[model samples]
Target: MGEWSPDTELDGYEQLVFLLPEEPTYALEPENSLVATLVRHDAPRYPSALLYLHGWKDYFFQTHLADEIDGPGYDFYALDLAATAARCGLSSSPATSRT
Candidate 1:
C-alpha cells in the first residue's frame, strides 16, 4: 500500500494507491496488476461512517456530499474503482470483477 497523500482533486480528502496481483490478460505479462485508489475524508464529526461508491466511468469528486454526511456525526469515504482517478495511469483496462 502506498502512503496516504492529500487529494488535490478533492478538498478535505486524502487518497492512497495500492496494487494487487491478478491474472494476466497477455502472455508476455505473467501477472496483471490491479491498481486501487482509496479516498477518505479526514476529521469526522463522529465515530459513525458512510461509504460512497461512484458508478461506471465515474470517480469520487463529490465534496458536498461528504460534507453533508460528515455533518451528521459520521465519517465519509469513497472507493475509486480501478483505472479511475489516482489509479488512472496505472492501468488501461477496466476491472472485470467487483469483489
Candidate 2:
C-alpha cells in the first residue's frame, strides 16, 4: 500500500510498517538493528495516521495492540529506534581518533 499522510483522516484498522535506520549511529554500524512501523486506516477521501515509537530493545510484536485498535476502519502504527550499545547489550563502536 502507498504511504499515508499524517494529516489524512483514517477510517478503520489498516496500517503500514516502515523500517528506519539511525543517521548518526549508522556510521558506527552497530551489530543490532532498529526498525519502525507506521500504521493507519487509509481512505481515498479521509485518511488517519498513528505513529508509535519503541525503544531499541523493545519491538512492536504485540498483536493484541493491533487487535484492540482493530475496528471497522481504524488504524495503528509502531516504530522502533536504534538504541545505544548500553541498551542493546552490545559492544559500542569506538570512535577513531585522528592525530
Candidate 3:
C-alpha cells in the first residue's frame, strides 16, 4: 500500500444496493439500491484511488485505508465483493459477478 501524502480531503465509496426494473421488451436490467460511505479524512486534496478485490470469506470493513486514501493527492477504496455477497465470483447476476 502506498502513502496518500497530506492534501487529500473528500474520500468515500459508493455501493450499489438495489436494482431498477426494466421493460419486458428490454434485454437487461439495472440495480435499484445502493449504500455509500463518506470516508473520514483529515487532509484536503486526495486525488488518487485504489480499489481492492475481496477474496472468499472477506468483506470490506477497514478504516485504515481511509487514512492512506485521505492524503494530499490520493484516495483508496477496499471492496470485499465475495464476502459482502453483493458482487463477486462466477455469477451472472451482476449483483455479485465480475469478469
Candidate 4:
C-alpha cells in the first residue's frame, strides 16, 4: 500500500496503490506484481459514498461519471482492478484472463 497521490489524469482526484501478494499471470516479469488502484476525491460533500469497479478491458478514467455522482452529495471512488490497470499501462503487467 502507498499514500494517496495526485491523479495524473483526473483533476482534484487522488490515487492509492494497493499491492497484492497473489501471483499475477499477466505480469511481464516475475518481479512485476499485482496492484489495485483506488481513485478518490480529497473531500466528500456528504456521508454517502459510491464505490465502483471497472470491468474487463476497462479502467477508472470516467471523470464525468464521478462528477455526476459527486454532485448528488456522494463521495465517488473507483477500484481499478489489477488486470485492467495493466492494460492501461498503469501497472507493470499486461491484461490477464483472470479478474
Evaluation by TM-score, superior candidate among 2 and 4: 4
Better of 1 and 4 by lDDT: 4
Q: Residue 35 error for model 4, in Å?
A: 0.6
**How many backbone clashes are present in model 4?**
0
**lDDT score at residue 71, model 2, on the 0-100 scale:** 53
lDDT of 3 by residue, 29-60 (tens): 23432212122233334556665555344344
Clashes of each: 0, 12, 22, 0
Regions of model 1 farther than 4 Å from truth:
23-32, 43-45, 83-99
Off by over 4 Å in 3: 1-14, 17-45, 83-99
Taking all chains together, each candidate's TM-score versus the true structure is 0.66, 0.42, 0.36, 0.74
lDDT of each: 0.60, 0.39, 0.36, 0.69
Per-residue lDDT of candidate 1, residues 1-99 (tens digit): 567777646677787656645523344433545556667886445767888876345567788888898776888888766644323333332332222
Model 3 weakest lDDT span, ten residues long: 17-26
Instruction: Give the top-scoring candidate (TM-score).
Output: 4
Model 2 lDDT, full chain set: 0.39
Can you list the residue pairs that collide in candidate 1?
none
Angstrom error of the Cα, residue 72, model 1: value is: 0.7
Model 1 alpha-carbon miss at residue 35, Å: 1.2
Error of 2 at 16 (Å): 7.4
